[model samples]
Target: MNMDLTHVLDVAQLTDVGKKRDHNEDSVASDVSSGLLVLADGMGGYQAGEVASKMAVLTIMAEMKERLAGSSSGKIDVASGMQMESTLLRDAVAKANAGIYHASRTQPQCAGMGTTLVVALFTNDRVLVGHVGDSRMYRLRGDAFCQITLDHSLLQEQIRAGLITPEQARFSNHRNLVTRALGVDSVVELELHEHDVEAGDIYLMCSDGLSDLVEDDDIYLALRTLNANLTFAARHLVEMANDNGGYDNISVILARPRQPYSAGRHWRHRILGWLK
Candidate 1:
């Protein structure tokens, strides 16, 4: 199955610090060769958070480029593209953690700073996701949507153990507290997930700033309402969160998957696919 991807891939991203916060401490990076899109929301004392977030993004991207570029791993057959991507993504995150830890040790100002990471890697027929902390990845398929990754957070742990009801966790004082993140220690734990991808599927990578304030249903509506224009959708989505009471820094990335085959097919067929 040599699935050809759309020649033109479009991605949209937007970030805003809520009304209460002055600075947006989240950062995003896209590595097309490995098909990775990373989002990190930093948390720590004072300005250390922003420093950690920036370092995490840069470190991951740099490591990925260093490892994948001019390396034998990327020289594999097209048939093994999926496996190559998987390995690269895993290695990149580990390298990022190491770099963040090293930086924390070298700089007293950023010592102990940490950040949550959510990364999505797209392949010909699927998308692979890796995450730690509370940032999230979402997929929209046809008329339905689902969260393809889990949150490694204190609130989620409590909810899972039945120690706190979902409602309580939503408004809990410890809701923003995360259980896992990079740069806090020498090593970090990560979660990786995968899903079948299709043309017309829409993907969203965001931090807790957006997810905490905006509900899933609202996201679905926004995508439908925006007609999938990159700039319009990204800005409006951020604006929605800001209007809803900007409590924290908001970040968003919206991407729509297109099929190579569809480009040469009958225009009406493509239109009918949506109607169906």
Candidate 2:
């Protein structure tokens, strides 16, 4: 994708151990220059969860960065109607999964460690969201807030099969029992979705720790109140989750579009203008 046609991103991220968790098992990474955001929520024994989450984030970031360096040509390759950006996003996730899975198998300490993942890559006119397990991506366009990624958990399957209602699934014991996760096996499937982005649109990528405890309406209110300040909005979301009996580690990433990329504009000036 042509960098000149894309929107500059304003990003803020925060992670917390939460009120009840003894250790944080979540990891987050953001590459503002490339408009990349990643979040992972891990599960395992002792410190393995933290290790797995970090590995997933680092692997994805490094792989994506390396591949994106060659994509400056701004040529969009199409395959079965999927854009080049989408293909790149998919390949990046697959590469991360391979690295994580290999480590889990070879390292005894990392045995059984797996993590939920959510990744957002912003191109010139669209954002590609790729996810596995239950970590999510939400978008706030104007006054409307909606979840853009679906969870790959048993509760979600049950809800889809009409075995339970949305209200019942909320209180279900299988909320955290994800049917898909990275590093759990040699390969994993990721659900990818694309959305057109606007200059005023705000995207939120978070772990289940925050979503499990906080109501969507409350989260929307928080975003609406502090949308103008990404840092404050991110910190407030973590605080709110802890206040509402944070039963797990919480992580949040906020990204907002600042301005469309213009070749004639100096990059430094544009960044300074957004910070102002």
Candidate 3:
């Protein structure tokens, strides 16, 4: 696809303090130029929660921006499609993890504080999704909205083990106990997924706030019917979460793939149609 004619991105972000939380601890950033959307949820017992999240968002994106600034977008011949796109996303996640861990060690108050990270990178007709911790990425296609990344949490493990039903785990005390996070260790394992994009597709990268307060079915239903407007989806998702008894900070970053008809392509098609 030509860079000019390929699907470009339109992004919207929204955050909330929720019904119980005094301050929002989640952070979201979108780089329309690079087609990058990142969301981080901080975990800490005290004020460090906000601190960790702030550091996480700033460090991760700063590193990613620096890397992209010097990037060559790879060769057009060998690297194309999902393979090249996924590699770029993986490298950025790795860099973010390393940066978070380094800050944890260097900063005193930041110790024992970590964050869940979810990133979505759009390249051509594919979206590369990567995550560490309970944060998530979702894609809406046609009439269905499905989670693209798996959650890294004890509750999820129990559900997988069949030790607890998903309904039971929804209210389980272990729901907040994340098994993986960006700054919790020197190395973090990331779950990566790639999906084919459609012209009307919508992508959501969100913190745990939405998942914790709102039900999965509700979220899916909302996204399934959500307008193509990215801002509408972002704002309404947070509002619904707040109304449903939000006890935590909520941050949502939304990006939609936009397919534009090029004048040349349109005229060519019209001419061909008339000739036929």
Instruction: List the candidate numbers ranked by lDDT, top first.
Output: 2, 1, 3
Candidate 1 lDDT at 268 equals 58
Instruction: Write model 2 residue lDDT over 1-276, tens digit each, in one string.
Output: 235332368899999999988899999999887888999999887888898899889988997877787774334576546666677778878887888788788889988898999998877557888999999999998899999988999999998999999899889888999999998988899898878888878999999989998899999999998999999999999989889898899999999887654333445667889999
Candidate that would win on TM-score: 2
Q: Candidates' lDDT values, in order? A: 0.76, 0.85, 0.75
Candidate 3 per-residue lDDT over residues 1-276, each given as its tens digit: 213222356788998888898777788887776667788898775766676677767766776666655544422325444454455566666766677678678878767778888887665456667888989888777778788887898888888999999889887877888899877788888788767778778788888899888877787777776765678878889999889888788988877767633335545767999999
What TM-score does candidate 2 get on C-alpha atoms? 0.90
Worst 10 residues of 2 by lDDT: 259-268
Q: By summed lDDT, which 10 consecutive residues of candidate 3 come out lowest?
A: 1-10
Reference-based lDDT, residue 84, model 2: 68
Worst lDDT 10-window in candidate 1: 1-10
Instruction: List model 1 lDDT by residue over 1-276, tens digit each.
Output: 112233535677777777998787899887553455789999876778888888888977786666555444323446545456566777777877887788778888877888999887666456778899999988777778888777888889988999998778878888788889988777787787677767788888989878888878898888777746866977877888888887889998876766623223434556799999
Q: How many clashes show up per model?
A: 1, 0, 0
* Model 1 residue-pair collision total: 1
